[model samples]
Target chain A: MATLSIENAGKSFGDTDVLKDISLSMDDGEFLVLLGASGCGKSTLLNMIAGLEKVSHGTIRVDGEVVNDVHPKDRDMAMVFQSYALYPNMSVEKNIAFGLEMRGVGRAERKAAVEEVARLLQIEHLLDRKPAQLSGGQRQRVAMGRALVRRPKIFLFDEPLSNLDAQLRVEMRTEIKRLHQTLKATMVYVTHDQIEAMTLADRIAVLKDGRIQQIGTPSEIYNTPANVYVAGFVGSPAMNFFEVTLERDGDQIGVMLPAKLKGVDTPYFLPLPAGGQYHSHIGQPVVLGLRPEMISQATTAAPEDPVITCDVDVVEPTGADTLCVIRLAGRGAKARVSPAFACEPGDSMEFALDMSRACVFDAETGMRLYG
Target chain B: MPQPKGGSSHRTVLDKLSRFLPQLVVAPSFLLILFFVYGFIIWTGYISFTDSRMLPAYEVQGFRQYFRLFAMDRWDVAFDNLLVFGAFYITLSLAIGCLLAVLLDQRIRAEGALRTIYLYPMAISFIVTGTAWKWMLNPSLGIESYIRGLGWESFRFDWIVDKDMAIYVVVIAAVWQASGFVMALFLSALRSVDQEIVKAAYLDGASTTRIYLGIILPSLRPVFLSAFVILAHLSIKSFDLVVALTGGGPGYASTLPANFMYEMTFRRNQIGLGAASAVMMLLTVAAIMVPYLYSELRGKRHA
Candidate 1:
């Protein structure tokens, strides 16, 4: 295993900059996942580390040695592609042995290595069969076997499980995590799936529009997202954003919600957490970032929780939790409640908002305002 | 009830006509092929057993023409030339075509124009190719005199007139006309190869040459079989090229089997012997085609 450091790395195709001023470093045996939507430069960054692509700006050092000019094979990295890119003409044994043969390994050693990998991957029976003869999952195993036989310094997986079926994808995802733990190899995995990043990565780097938006542990990224984009991109059912003006109500600072209490024209005031950084910004516009789980049925509310009542616009039952869309502060917001909480569209329901977990962002800049 | 019976009867007649329409449309061409192609083959087979000369007389003298065809010195020379020409032509064309295709697949800038230039000769008839090569190989008129004019007095490119070398001239013309078509076949096959496999091989530490030989070329076995089958048939039935370029001349020194059959049938009035030669040519083509067809069809069935 080796530490990989990408320093001030940038890539440009003619005039279009795909990745700009990106700097990331990994400790030995650390799993770093680069997560983003499509066209967000995560795959390009992974390719640069693998030497499949050249860094247009800065140096990439592996194990403290600059490898900008090194060939990919000499750099000693193994990659598993999304397509599983197995050589179709070769039997599974030969496919796994091809890299070792290219590295000039002896026949007996190559055979032993192939046998070991085949047993580890549970594919010994598939050794004599060609890639076309294998199922999708079997082919994925062979692709991994081809990479593992060489015992490279680093493992690079470019959306390797994306091509499998949903059920098989989760199974392989767990297997990859288990393998990473057992092998203790420095791995850099690139994927657009947030769940994969959350489940596999030691630290997740969320990327957007060719820039790193946030880099943290999965809970840190999900709980305290750096900005509105990170808040929205990293979660299922997405964090709700409420555009509201901060009001100084006596000694407490709070945001006024547009929901009515009974039949009155008065707006509901939900108090912010005590002593937030936005205390001095009273009467300024800010976006309140609240995850769906932060708002729930009033029955589950703690005594200190702030409560508000709103008309439900839509309800989506996802088995474990029912997601209710309600209007607050003149914008749509999602609330996660128990499926047993019987409510429908056009029904008035009381939702308890957990103030401590909610974040406020600057309305104009979209940056988080309070720590 | 009577009106309903009449409507049902009308519908049945229309259905019968619809079923017969496709067969009716195909019958003319099918009958024409059966009479002209297969019928003539049977008639030719029968005539080979008779002693027909100057005209076809259908009185059987069994195996007489085959004995005479085997005894003739001209027939021996033609058979020998076919073996030499077919062997060299198919091998050289396949090698040259595959090389050109590999070169073109290198993401070249002017690839469209270059591919068209290579493939333009295939658009012209084989007769045109033979005539062009005939002019180019003429000692007094073409490359020989042209080079001699530039003060190289020892330049001698008179392969067209050289009795011992004239058959190779036919091989050259055939290779030139067909190699580009073969290149087109190979280029498409190369294009269809999964590029990610090459990238994976590169990361595996294989050089560009090794990647192609070990992975890419092995996957192109089907294309190789296809090119071989096509070139084989073209070599066996090579008639117009020999006729247009050499005219079986320099005292019948470079005569191929087809040219020999023509000379015996129409020119020397040895019709029965010509039929026997034609039957031999058919057997040679069938020997190549039968196994190829069986294997190809069997592969499709398994797939």
Candidate 2:
């Protein structure tokens, strides 16, 4: 395992910058995922790290040595492509052994390494089959086997599970996490998939438009997103954003939501947890971000909890929890309630809004105001 | 709507006609190919069985013409020439074409211009290629004279006039005319190879040479088979090139089967023997093409 540090790395094609000032460092055996939407330059940054693409600016250091101009072959990094990219002409055994052979490993050692990887991946039976003869999941296993056999200093995966079916994607995602845990190899995975990043990354660097939006642990990213974008991107059904005017009520700070939201005639004053960061925003419009899980059925209605009656617009049952679509502040917001407590579409239900974990963003800048 | 019953019946007839239109449009070409290609093949096969000397004859010969054709020394030379020419032509074309294709796939500048230049010879007719090479191979008129004028007095290049070496000259001309087409085919297949595979190989620590030899070229086996089949048929039916280049000269040393058939049927007035030779050429082409086509179609079905 090796430590990789990219200092102010930037890439440009002509005038169009594909990645701008991307700088993140990973400790040895760290699983750092570059998460972003397509065209966000996550893959570009991964390629830069792998030496497949030039950094264009700044320096890439591996184990404290500058390797900016190094060839990909000399970089000691193995990449798993999104397409699996098994050599169609080679059998599974050869596909895994090819890297070792290229590195001048002895024939007997190569065979031993191939067999060990195959046994670890439970693909020993598939060693003699060509890539075309394997199913999609089997190909994915062989791809991982190929990377695993190299035992490289760094592993780069570019959306490796995106091509698999949903069921297989999940299976392989878990397998990758297990592989990372077992080997403790320094890995840089790039994908647009947030769930994969949440489950697998030791630290996730959420990127947008060639710039990193946030870099944080999974819990930090979920419970305390760095900005409005990260808040909406990480959660299923997405976090809800409400444009509201923060008001001061004699040492208590809160926002008054539309009374019609709960089918009530008068407005409801919901108190936000007090903080100096939010005090300056009183009497100014701010975007309030709340995750769906934070708003749940008020079954036990603790005295400190604030409850709001909502007109359930639609109910989506996703097995464990039912999502109720409700209108709040003139826009629809999803509220997660237990399936047992979920009400009908036309009915009104009471939801406990967890203001303790709410995120408030500056309306003009879309930056996080406070917790 | 008012005349519903009759109108519905008329609509059914129109629908039927529309469905039949596709088949109707293709019928003429189908009939033409059937009569001109397959019909002539059948007619030739029958003529080979008859003792049709100097003209068409209905008298059964029962392999008499075939025995006479095989016994002829001229036919022996031509058949031997075909084997030499076909083997050399197919092997050289595939090797040269694949090399050119691999070179052009390097994302080099001016690739379009280079590809067009390499493929330009394929656009010329084989007969034209043959005549042009004939002039160039002429001892007094072409390279030998030019080199001698350039102070190389002892230089002599006269393969076109040499009996043992004349077939090689045809091989060279045929390869020049067809290697370009083979290159075009290989280039298209090379372009369609998944680029990610190359990148994966690069990251696998494979050198450029190893990547191409171990991974890329081996994956192009189907294209190699296709090129082989096409060049095999072209070599077997090579008639015009030899006729224009050597005219089976130097005592019939460069005559292919097609040229032999022409000489026997029209010049020697041996129709039955000529038909037998033509049938043999047909069988040779079929032997190469049938298996290739079968495997290709079978592969597609499995895919």
True contacts kept of each: 0.76, 0.85
Candidate 2 runs further than 4 Å off:
A259-266, B1-32, B149-151, B297-303
Q: Give candidate 1's error at residue A336 in angstroms.
A: 2.7
Highest DockQ against the true fold, candidate: 2
Give lDDT for model 2.
0.90
Off by over 4 Å in 1: A259-267, A328-333, B1-28
DockQ of each model vs. true complex: 0.74, 0.80
Q: CA lDDT of B52 in candidate 2?
A: 89
lDDT tens readout by residue for model 2, B101-169: 999999999999999999999989888998899999999999899999999999999999999999999
lDDT of 1 by residue, B47-78 (tens): 99999999998999999999999999999999
Clashing pairs in 1: none
